[model samples]
Each structure stands twice: as C-alpha cells, then as structure tokens.
Target: MHKRLFIPGPVEVREDILKKMSTPMIGHRSKDASKLQKSISGKMKKLMYTDNEILLSTSSGSGLMEGAIRSCTVKRAAVFSIGAFGDRWYKMAVCNGVQADKISSEPGQPTLPEMVDKTLATGKYDLITITHNETATGVMNPVEEIAEVMKKYPDVVYCLDAVSSLGGTKIEVDKLGVDICITSSQKCLGLPPGLSICSISQKALDAAKKVEFRGLYFDLLELYEYIKKKDYQYPSTPSLSHMFALDYQLDRIFEEGLENRFERHRKMAEYVRQWAKERFALFADERYASNTVTAVKNTRNIDVSELNKKLGEVGYVISNGYGQLKDITFRIAHMADTTLDEIKGLIESIDKIIM
Candidate 1:
C-alpha cells in the first residue's frame, strides 16, 4: 500500500499535477523553453509577492540557500537558528569557508527580533539568514517583526529559508525586504523534488559582483545573468520535467486562490493544534507554532517507530521528531495540498491507535 505522506516535503501530489510531469522533452535553449520558463517566472512573481528577479535552480532549496550566502556575503554572515535547518545553513557557511557566526534560540523557540537587532548593532556582518518555518521543531519565525528590525540594517543582505513555508504561508518578499527568499518544489508548492526557486533583489546581485569564489554551479550572479542574457534559460540543462509539473501546479494553486490556499493550510494547522492540545502537548510555543507542521511533545512516551509502522500499514504516515527530538516529540505536517478533512481523518486514526 502506498502510504499517504503527512510528513514534511514531497507532500502528496495531486494526480493531475503528477501527469503534468510527463510532458515531452524540449530543447533547453529553444524559444519554446523560454516561453515555458517565462510563464513560470511570471506566475512565481505573483505567488511570492515580489518584483525581484526570479531565479530557478535544479537542486533542493539548500542549493539557493548556499548560493545566497556564498554569493552575497562579502564581509561576514550572522546565521540564526531555531532548529535543524538553521544549523544546516551555518554548516553550509562553514564548509564553504564563508565567514559566519551562528547564534541560536532554545529548541522550540523562535528567533527573536531583539536578538537580530543586537547582532546587527555590532556592525560586523553584512548578510543574515533566518529560517521562516523550521520543520524540525515546528517553529515559524516572526518574519514580520524581524523585517522591521532588518530595516535598520539596510546594507545587510537578508536571506530567508522559506523551504517549508513559502507557498503555504503568506510571506510578502518585497515588503519583508528579503534580498533572497528560498523555497523548494516538494513542500508547500506540492510538486516533486529537484527544483528550487528564489526571489533575488538587485541589492543582493550587486553584492555578489564584489565577492570572489562564489562557485559556479550555485552562483547566483551567473544564474541571474544567464536568465537575463539568454532569455530565462539556465546556465546548465535544467530539470524540464519538474518545471513542467510546477507550471501546472502553480496554475492550480492560483485557481484555488492564494488566500484560499493559505486559509486551508491555516484551518488544517488549527485542527491539528487543537487535537494535540487535547491529547499530547505541543513542542513549540503556541504563539510561534508552524502552520505547515506541528511537533507534538511525547508526553505519553508512545513508541513512535511502532506507531509509524501501524500507521504505515493503514496507509498513513507522519514524521518522528527530527534530530534529538526524535521520540521526545513527533511531527504532523499539514502543508501543500493536504486538506482539512484529511487532517481530521489522520488525527482520528491516531486517536484510535492510541486509545
């Protein structure tokens, strides 16, 4: 039996969206390809609420996260962590030899704006990264409040890892003054993995021009220049299959309406939160809980692996808490195309098993 994914990412793709991936091949440099790429970019601009240049990469959201940090950080970077993905960004910066410092909140806590304000006040960093929705601990950082703090440090390039939040949540990229907002196909976009998209402000592009050794494969400057020079084509052969599916999926998302889509996710999240409150305790602060996923504290000390096995046999699968939180907490993802009915059913199924 195919288990329905209630875990984060590679979320249940609708059949119509899956079939769109079967589109026939197209020459990477052809005008037809340009038309398709342009169409997707135009739609993505609307979805992200940004007029910034849209750049597509044939890698996970991490590719662009790495690209943005490496390309724009001429001086140093301050990477804030609320969970695993935030740590991953710090790791990427270290491994790439990019000058960076990692500061973190206690697990299950959000990265506060006051923390950012204090860090930027030091005037040692020129770039900053904030994870918008961290899947591991199910915490969503307050970007709106953080954006207000960032306005004070306009010269610092603001990068956000919206990998698990972008399409499912409301993030006004331009209004947030985010120089680079990164998201992937598999999460809220409801498309298969392999392609990542980002909205890059010209301010970030200008910063990249002054930096050296930005690397080729994930170079933001090179990617953007190619799109501008070659009419929306990537520097290398792109993932045409994923692009085809994404184009179709974006149309469906719009048809459903952005406000409606966000509201659907909100409803599903609220239902899960209420259920968790009635049964298990929530791991994240109620004020900062993620709309895409909820991490529940394992107060009952249930055997999560055993629970997953039982759920798997019944054609449903959620996620164990990520990293050290495994068994201490478990996560239920409610993003992408997952509906309120499906969420209710999953919770009821779990209730029966626990009962």
Candidate 2:
C-alpha cells in the first residue's frame, strides 16, 4: 500500500523534486558541481534568513548537530532538553568528550527562558545546544526569548537543532544569534533524507579553530576554508543527488513565499490542535505548540496499534508516541508539502475511526 506519510520526516516528496534527484551524475569537483553548490547556498541563506555561510553535509541533521557541538564547544556547554531530541544533544556532547551539563523542562513544557539565563550566567559554559522544535513532544522552544538572554553572554556560542522546523517556520537564524543552525533535507524542507545543512557563523568557525579535535569530515573551519578557497564546494565528495533535489525544492518553497509557507504550516497545525482538543488533548503547552506536528494525548486510551493498522489499510499513516510517551500520545506531522485539505481529509477519516 502506498500509505501517505503523516508521520514526521520523509514526508511525501514532490514528484518534480524527486525527478531532480535523478539528474545525471556530475563530478563532485566539476564546474557544474561548484555552480550548483554555490547557488544552493545562496538559496539556503535566504530560506534560513541568515547571511552567514551555509555548510552542507551528506549525513542526517544529527551529524551536523554533533559536529557543531564537538567543533565549537571550546570551554563548556549547557545543553537544554524540552524533549527527547534535546536530551540527545547532551548525549552527543558527552559522547564527543565535550564538557557539558544538561537542563530540562518537564515533558510537554517549553524550556523556560529563566532556566537558560540561570545556566548561562554561571559563566562555566561557552556553548549551548537547543532543539528548536521537538517532534517527540511537539514543542517549539521560545527561540526569540532565548535570543534575548543570549545577548548577555557574548562569548557563548549558540547552536540549535532545527532538524524538523527549519522550512516550516521563520527561524531568523542570524537574528536569533544562532552560531550554527542545523537542519536536515527531510522534515520541513520537504526533500528526501540525506543532506544536513548548517548556517555557520564566523564565531563558530573561530571557535572550531581553537578546538584541538574538531574532527575531519565535519570540521567547521575546514569546511569554511574549502569553500573560501575552492569557491563553494565541500572538502569531501558531496552528495550531488540530494543537492539537486534540495536546490530545486528550495525554489518551490520560496515560490510559496516564506511567510506564506510559514502561515500554511501554522494554520494546519492549529487545525490539528483544535481537532485534537475537541476529542483528546494537545500534549504540549498551547502557547509553545509546534507548527509542524501536533502531539495529541491519548485520552481515550483506544487501541493505537489497531488504529494504525486500519489507517494503513486506507493508505494513511501517522505516528504513535515517541520514547516514553508511546501509546500515551500520538503525533501527526503537518509539515513540508502537506496541505490543508490533506490535513482535513486525514482528520476526517481519523474522526470516523475514533468518534
């Protein structure tokens, strides 16, 4: 069954974008490749709302996330968790031997601004990792409010995991004071999985220069030097396939207009939230809800597995709870190319099943 993905990520790719991925293989070092790479960076800069240099990785968003922390955390990091993804950032820091501590908000809660302030004011940390939108809990952290606190700590590097929210929201990367805003090709970007992109500020690049083991392949300063000298190309052979698709898809996103695209995502998300509240409940704070997916509490305690089986039969699929919330909550993505009508249709069908 060609079950439509209402689950997060690898969300139904547009056929045209898929076709672009099949484009004839170009030598990674060829002029064509450089042109494509350079062009895509410009487009991505516009999309991310940043003037900083953008780096492309052939790995998932987590890859760049780990790279950001490992490469830039020269002193120490304060990693904050609002959900599973944020916690994973702290894990990434520890595994990389980066000195760090973890702070967290209750599940279904936003990581409060005061918490970030208290932690940063200690002067023991020089880098911070935050997950902007957590698919696991359907919470969007208050990035703007956090940015206000960041202004006080000039030396601290601000890194964000925007793996799932980049294209669906107005992240304002530079404005948000994000030194490295990491995101993936899948998720809100509406492209297939493979490439992870990051907007790297000069601050992060300088920080990477001081770190002893910034690691090859993902070394931020190395990537920057390569592009500066070689005219916008990766130090390693890049994935031309994902780049072609992303390059094309970013145009489609702009065609939708950035604000308009963000609005569509917000509208779809609100629609789902309202629907979920009428029947069950939204898992996170209403004020901090995600604009890409909604995690609805399992108030009815119905057979979620059975519900999925029935949905699969009808060519539709959504996500059950993530991690500890499994079965206690369910998630439905409203990101990428997912439309209002599609959202309405899915909700109507699910309503028939549950109501």
Candidate 3:
C-alpha cells in the first residue's frame, strides 16, 4: 500500500498539480516559457508579500541559502540557530570563507529579539540569517519580533530561511526588512522536489557586487541580472516542469484566499498540538511552536521505528526525529495540501495502535 506522507517535504501533491507537471515540454527561450516564468514569479510575490525580485533556482532550498550567504555578506554574518537548518547556515558561511558567528538557543527556546539587537548593535556584522521554522526542534522563531529589532540596523542585510513555513504561513518579506528570503517547492508549495525560490532585495544585489567570487550557477548577481535583462527566463535551462506545477498551484492557493490557507495550517497545527499534549509532550516551546510541523518528545521512549512500521501498514507515514533526535523524538508535518480531516484521520490511526 502507498502511504500518505505527513513528513516535512514532498508532501502529498494533489492529482491536478501532478498533471500540471506533465505539461508538454517547451523551449526554455521561447515566449511560452517566459510567460509561464513571469506568471509564476508574479504569483510568488503575492505569496511572499514582497515587491522585491524573486529568483527561482533549479536546486533545493539549501542551494538558495548557500547562494545568498555566499553571494552577499560583505562584512560579517550573525547566524542564529534554533535547529538544524540554522546550523547549516553557519556551516555555509564558514565553508565559503565568510566572517560569521554562530549563536544558538536551547533546543526548544526561541531566539529572542533582544539577542538580535544586542548582537547587531556592535556593528560587528552586516548580514544576518535566521530560520523562520526549524523542523528538528519544531520551533518557529519569533521573526515578527525579530524584525522589530532589525529596524534599528538599516544597513544590515536580513535573510530568512522559510523553506517550510513560506506557503503555510504569511511572511511579509518587504515589511519584515528581509534582504533575502528563501524557500523551496517541495515543502509547503505542494509540489515535487526540484525547484526553489527566493526574494532578493536590491541591497543584497548591491552587496554581491562587493564580493569578488560570488560563484557561478547559483550566483545571486548573475542570476538576477540575467533574469532582468532577458525578461523572466534565467541564465539556466530551468526546470520547466516544476514551473508549470508551481504556476497552477499558486492559482489554487490564491483562490483559497491566502488568509484562509494560513488559517487552515494554524488549525491543523493546533489540533496536532492539543492531541500531542494529551499523550506525548511537544518538544518545542508552546509559544514558539511551528504551524507546519510538530516535534513530540519521546515521553514513553517507545520504539519509533516499530510505531512507524505499524503506521505504514495503515497507509500513513510520519517522519522520525531529525539528526540527533532520531528515535528519541518524532515529527508530524501538517503542511502543503494536507487538511484537518486528513490530520484527524492520521492521529486517529496512531491512537488506535498506541492507545
């Protein structure tokens, strides 16, 4: 039996969205391709609530995260870690020889606004990267409050990794003062893996000019310039299939009303959190819990592998804990096209086996 995915990414793509991916192949440089690209980008701006230029890459979210950090960051970067994705940002900075310092909060704690203010007030960094949602710890950093602190530093470039939260939550990129906000298609966009998107503020592009080696392929400046000069087409043989699905997906998302879609995610997350509280405990802070996924502490130390096996037999599969949390804790994602009824059914099935 094929199991339904309630794990993080590549979540269930509806049949219509899958069919869109099968759209006939088109020449990358043709007018049809440009039109499709333009439509996708335009709708993406609505989704992200940004007027800044959005760039689509033919790689997972990590590619754009690396590209943004490597391309920009002239002086230094303040990398904040709430979980795995945040740590990866610091690694990306160090691997590329960028000046960056890694800061971390306890596994379930939120990175406070004052912390960002204190770090950036020293004028020690010109760029900062934050993960809006961390799957491992299931912590949703207080980006809204953090953005308030960022207002004090007008010159600093703010970047956010919203790979899992972008489609499920409403993140106002422009109002948030984010220079580079990144997300991928597979996570909340309800599409298969292959493409990623990021909004590039003018400041980030200008900063890239100062860096001598921005690297090709994923270079921010080069990609931005190419797309601008050539209309919507990139300097790449872009993944046209992902584009077709994304364009159609965005229409469905908008038709559902952005507010309604976000509300649905919040409702599903709330249901999961309340249910988990009755049995297991949430790993992340209640105040900072994620709307896309919930990480539950292993209160019983039950065999996660065995439990998941049983779940598979029931036509459902949720994620085991990530990295170090493996077998110690497990995760249940509620993003993309997943609905409350589906969530209820998954929980009901798990209860039947466990309870």
Candidate 4:
C-alpha cells in the first residue's frame, strides 16, 4: 500500500503537481528554458515577498545554506541552534573550515532575540545563520523579533534556513532583512525534492565577492553572476523538471492565496497540537510551536515504531521523533497541501489505535 506522508518533507504532492514534473526535458540554455526560469523567479519573488536576487540550485536547501555561510562570512559566523537542522548548519560551517561559533537553545526552546543580540554584541562575528523553523523539535524561531536584533548589527550578513517553513508561512524576506533566505522544493512548496531556492540581498552578494575559495559548484557569487549574465539560467545544467513543477505549484499556491495557504497550515498545526495535548503532550514550547509540524512528547512511552507500523497498514504514516528525540517523542507534519480534514482524519486514526 502507498502510505500517505504525514512526515516533515516529501509531503503529499497533488497529482497535478506531480504531472508537471513529468514535463519533457528542455535545453537548459534555450530561450524557452530562460523564460520558464524567469517566470518561476518572478512568482518566487511574490511568494518570498522580496526583491532580492533569486537563485536556484539543483540541490537541497543545505547546498544554499552551506554556500551562504562559506561565501559571505568575512570575519566569523554565529550559528544559533534550536534543534538538529540548526546543528547541521553549524556542522556545515565547521566541516567547511569556516570560523563559526554555535549558540544553542535547549531542545524544545527557541533561539531568543536576546541570544542573537548577545552574540552579535561581541563584534567578532560578521555573519549569522538562524533556523527559522527546526523540524526535529518542531520549533519555529521568531524571525521577526530576531530581525529587530539584527538591525543593531547592520554589517553582519543574516541567513535563514527556512527549509521547512517558507511556502507554508509568511516570511517577508525583504522586511526581515535576511541577507540569504534558503528553502527547498520538498518542504512547504508541495513539490518533489531536488531544487533549492534562495532570495539573496546585494549585501550578501557583495560579501561573496570578497571571499576566496568558495568552491565553484555552490559559489554564491558565481551563481548570481551566471543568472545575471545568462538571463535566469543556472551555471550548470538546471533541474528543468523540478522548475516546471515549481512554476505550476506556485500558480496553485497563489490561486489558493498565500494567506489562505498559510492559514490552512496554521489550522492544521493547531489541530495537531490540540490533539497532542489531549492525548500525549506537546514537546515544543506552545508559543513557538511550528505551524508545519508538531512534536508530541511520548508521555505514555508508546512504541512509536509499532504505532507507525499500525498506521502504515491503514495507509497513513507520520514521523518518529527526530535524532535524540526518537521514541521520546513523535512528529506529525501538517505542511504543504495537507488539508485540515486530512489532519483531523490522521489524528482520529491515531486515536483509534492509541485509545
């Protein structure tokens, strides 16, 4: 049986969106390809609410996250972590030999604005990365509040990992002063995995120009220059397949309305949280709970693997708690095209099995 995905990413793609991906291949350098790329970028601007230069990479969001940190950090980077994804960002920095310091919050907590302020006050860091939403713990950082703290350090390039939040929520990239806001195709975009996208401010591009050894494939400056010079074309062969689907998906998103899409996600999230609270216990801080996924504390110590097995038989599947939280908690995703009715049905199914 094909189980429905209620996990964080690779969400249930609508049949129409999947069909768009089956579109025949086009020459990456052809005018038709440029037009498709141009159209997607324009629509992405409306979705991201930014006028910054948009870049697409044929990799997951991590590719851009790594590129942003490696190419733009002139002095050092302050990475704030609330969960595994944030930790992964820090790891990317360290492995790349970038000078970075990790400032982490407890598992279920958030990276507070004060934490950002304190880190930036040291004057030793010129770049910062914040995970806007961490899937592991289901905690959404308050980017708006953190943006206020970032204003105090204007020279620092601010990066956001919106991998799991961007399309599902309202992230005003320009208003937030995010130098580089990264997101992937799979998460909230309701598309298959393969493409990574970002809105890059000129400040970040300028910083990238000064940095050396920013490996070619994911180089921010290189990618930006290629897109500008080639007219919306990528430096290497692009994922035209994903781009076609993304373009179509963006149309669907806007047709439904961005606000309506976000509201749908919020309603699904709230329903999941309430269900978790009534049965198990909510793992993340309620105030900062994610609007895409819910991390429920396994107060009753249920065998999550067994639960998933049972749910799979019924054509439903959620996620076990990520990383260290496995078995200790469980996660139910409500992002992408998932509807409130679908969420209610999943919870009702769980109730039948658990109760």
Candidate 5:
C-alpha cells in the first residue's frame, strides 16, 4: 500500500506535478534554460513578497544556509535557535570555520524579539540567522516582531531559514529586512526534494564581496554574479528535472491562489493543534505554534513506533519527534497540498487506534 505522507517534507506531490519531473532534458547553458529560470524567478518574487534577486541551487536548503553564513559574515554571526534546525545552522557556521555564537531558547519556545534586541545591542556580530519555522518542536518564530528589533541594527545582515514555512505562511522578506531568505522544494512548495531557493538582497550581495575565503561551490557572490552575467544560468549544472517540476508547480500554486493556500494550511494546523490539546497535549507554546506542523506531547506514553506501523497499515504515515524530543513527542505535518479534510482523517485514525 502507498502510504500518504504526513511528515514534514517530501510531502504528497500531485500526480501532475510528479509528471513534470519527467520533462525532456534541456541544455543547462541554453537560452531556453535561462527563459525557464527567469519565469520561475518572477513567480517566486510574488510568492516570497520580495523585490530581491532569486537564486536556485541543486542541493537542499542547507546549501544556501551554509552559503549565506559563509559568504555574508564579515565579522561574526549570532545564530538564534528555537529548535534542532536552528542549531544545525550554527553548526554549519562552525564547520565552515566562520566565527559564530549560538544563542538558543528552550525547546517548545521561540527566539523572542527581546532576545534579538539584547544580542544585537552588544555590536559583537555583523550577521544573524533565525529559523522562521522549526519542524522539530513545531515552533514558529515571530519574524514580524523580530523584524522590528532588527531595524535597530541597520548593518547586520539578517539571514532567515524559511525552509519549512515560506509557502505555508506569509514571510515578507523585504519588509523583514532579511538579507537572505532560504527555502527548499520539498516542504511547503509542494514539489519533490533537490532544488533549494533563496531571495538575496543587494545588501547581502555587497556583504559577500567583502569575505575573502568564501567557499567556491556554495559561494553566494559567485552564484549571484554568474546568474547576472549568464542571464539566470547557474555556475553548476542545475537540476533540470526539479526545475521543470518547480516551474510547473509554481503555476499550480498560483492557480490555487496564495492567500487561499495559506488559509488552507492555517485551518489544517488549527484543527490538528486542537485535537492534540484535547487528547495528547501540544509540545510547543500555542502562541508560537507553527502553521505547517504540530508537535504533540506524548502524555499517554504511547509507543510511537507501533502507532506509525498501525497508521502505515491504514495507508497513512506521520513522523516521530526529532532529536532529543524523539518518542516524547510526535509530529503531524499539515503543509504542502494537504487539506483540512485529510488532516481530520489522519486524526480520526489515530483516535480509533489509541482510544
């Protein structure tokens, strides 16, 4: 039986979107490739709510996350962690030999605006990275509030990891003063994994020019300049398959209407969160709960593996908690093209099995 995915990523792709991946190969250097990429960029700008230039990479969202930190941090970086993914960003900075400090919040909480204001007040860092939505703990940072705090420090290059939230929620990159906003095809974009995308501000590009040893392949400056020079062609042989699917998927997204899509995700998330509260309890604070996924606390101490096995038998699958919270909490993702009715169905199955 083919189980429906209720996990965070690699979400259920529509049959039509899946077929787009099989599109005929195109020369990566050809003008056709440039046209296709340019078309995607124009649509992406509308989706991201930014006038900044768009960059696409064949690797996962981590590729751009690493690139943004390595290329834009001229002095040092302050990474705010609301959960596992945020910590991973800090680790990427460390592994790249970039000077960085990790400031973490307790799990199930958010990286508050006050935390950002206090950290930036010291003037010790020139770059800051914030995870907009964390799948592990199902916490969504308050980017609007944080954006207000960010305005206090004009020189800081603000990098945001919207990998799991971008398409599911509204993230105004330009209004938030985000120098780089990164996301992947797998999560809320309703596409298969492979390509990662970002909107890079002119400020970020200028910051990258000052860094001397920014790595070659993931170099933001190199990628930016080449795309401008070659008219949207990537320095590396891009993932034409994913590009085809993404280009088609963006059109589908438009047809659905962005506001309608976001509202659908919001309704699904609210339903799941209410169900969790009534039964198992929520792991993250309700005020900061995510619109894409909900982390339910396992108050009943049910065997999560067994529950997943039962769900699989019923043609559905969810996710176990991530990292330290594993088994203590279970996550039900409501992003991508999942409808409120489908979310209710998954909850109904779980209720039948557990109760």
Candidate 6:
C-alpha cells in the first residue's frame, strides 16, 4: 500500500504536480529554458513577498544556507539555534572555516528578539542566521519581532532558513530585512524534493563581493551573477525536471490563492495542536508552536514505532521525533496540500488505535 506522508518534508505531492516531472527535457542553455526559469522567479518573488532577485539550486535548501553564510560573512557570523536545523547552520559555518559563534536556545524554546538585540549590540558579527521554522522541535521563531532587532544592525546580513515555513506562512522578506531567505521544494511548496530556492537582497550580493574564498558549487555570488548575466540560467546544469514540476506547481498554488493556502495550513495546525494538548503534551511552547508541524510529548510512553506500523497498515504515516527526541515525542506534519478534512481523518484513525 502507498502510505500518505505526514512527515515534515517530502510531503505528499499532488498527482498533477508529480506528472510535471515527466515533462520532456529542454536544453539548459536554450532561451526556452531561460523563459521557464524567468517564469518561476517572477512567481517566487510574489510568494516570498520580496523584490530581491531569486536564485535556484539543484541541491536541498542546505546548499543555499551554506552559500549565504560562506558568501556574505566577511568578518564573522552569529548563528542562532532554536532546534536541530538551527544547529545545522552553525555547523555549516564551522565546516566552511568561517568565523562563527553559535548561540542556542533550550529545545522547545525560541530565539528571542532580545537575544538577537544583545548579540548585535556587541558589534562582533557582520552576518546572522536564523531558522524561521524548525521541524525537529516544532518551533517557529518570531521573525517580525526579530526584524525589529535587525534594523539596529544595518550592516549585519540577515539570513533565514525558511525551508519548512515559507509557503505555509506569510513571511515578508523585504519588510523583515532578510538578506537571504531559503526554502526547498519538498516542504510546503507541494512539490517533490530536488530543487531549492532563495531570494537574495542587493545588500547580500554586495557583501558577497568582499568575501575572498567563498567555495564553488554553492557560491551565492556566482549563482546570482550568472543568472543575471545569462538571463535566468544557472551556472550548473540545472534540474530541468524539477524546474518543470515547480513551474507548474507554482501555478497550482496561485489558483488555490496564497491567502487561502495559508489559512488552510493554519486551521489544520490548530486542530492538530488541540488534539495533542488533550491527549499528549506539546513539546514546544504553545506561543511559538509551528503551523506546519507539531511535536507531541509522549506522556503516555506509547511505543511510537508500533503506532507507526499500525498507521502504515492503515495507509497513513507520520514521523518519529528527530535525533534525541525520538520516543520522547512524535511529530505530525500538516503542511503542503494536506486539507483539514484529511488531517481530521488521520487524527480519527490515531484515536481509534490509541484511545
């Protein structure tokens, strides 16, 4: 049986979107390819609410995350962690031999705006990275509040990992002063994994020009300049298959209406959170809980693996806690094209098995 995915990423793709992948190949350097890419970039700018230029990579969202840190941090970076994905950013900085310091919040907590303010006040960093929504602990950082703090440090290049949140929520990248906002196809975009997308501000591009050793393959500056020079074509042979699917999927998203899509995700998240509270405690703070995924504390100490096996038999599948949180908590993702009715059906099935 084909099980429905309720995991944080690689969420269920619509049949029509999946079919777009089979679209015939086109020459990556052809004008037709450029037109296709330009279409995607135009639509993406609207979705992200940014006037910043768009860049697409064939790798996961991590590719751009690494690129943004490596390309823009000429002095040093202050990396803030709200969960596992946040820590990953800090690690990327270290591995790249970039000067960086990791400031972390307790699991299930948020990276407070005051924390950002205090860090920037010291004037020790020129770039900062924040995870807008973390799937591991199901926490969504308050970017609007953090944006206010960012305004004080005008020189600091603000980078956000919106890999799991961008399409599911409203993030005004320009208003937030985000120099780079990164997301992937696998999450809330309702497409299969392959391509990652980002919006890069002019400020970020200027900062990248100062860095000397930004690595190849994931060089943000090279990618940005190449697209502009080549008219929306990538330096590398791009994932034409994913591009076809994404271009088509963006149209579908528009047809559904962005506001309607966001509201649907919000309603599904609320329903799941209420169910978790009544049955099992929530792992993250209620105030900062994510609208895409919910991590539920395993107060009942149920065998999570067994529950998943049962769910799989019933043609549905969710996720176990990530890393250390495994068995301590279980996750239910409510993003992508999942409807409120579908979410209710999944919850009812779980209730039948556990209640």
Any runs in candidate 5 off by more than 4 Å, and if so which? none
Model 4 TM-score, 2 decimals:
0.99
lDDT of 1 by residue, 1-355 (tens): 8999999987988899889889999999999899989999999999999999899999999999999999999999999999899999999999999999999999999999999999999999999999999999999999999999999999999999999998999999999999999999999999889999999999999999999899998999999999999999988999999999998899999999999999999999999999999898999999999999999999999998989998988899999989989879999999999999999889888988997
lDDT of 4 at 300: 91
Q: Which residue pairs collide, candidate 1?
A: none
lDDT of 2 by residue, 260-319 (tens): 999999999989999999999999999999999899999999888888898888889999
After aligning candidate 2 to the native by TM-score, how far in Å is the CA of 271 from where it should be? 0.4
lDDT of model number 3:
0.93
Kindly report which residue stretches of model 3 are placed more than 4 angstroms away from their true locations once superposed. none
Quote model 1's TM-score: 0.99
Query: Which residue pairs clash in candidate 2?
Result: none
lDDT at residue 71 of model 6 (Cα atoms): 95
TM-score of 5: 0.99
Model 4, 42-62: lDDT tens digits are 999999999988899999998
lDDT of candidate 5 over 42-128, digit per residue (tens):
999999999999999999999999999999999999999988999999999999999999999999999999999999999999999
Error of 3 at 30 (Å): 0.7
- For model 6, the local distance difference test gives 0.94
Tens digits of lDDT, candidate 6, 261-305: 999999999999999999999999999999999999999999989
- Model 6 misplaced regions, further than 4 Å: none
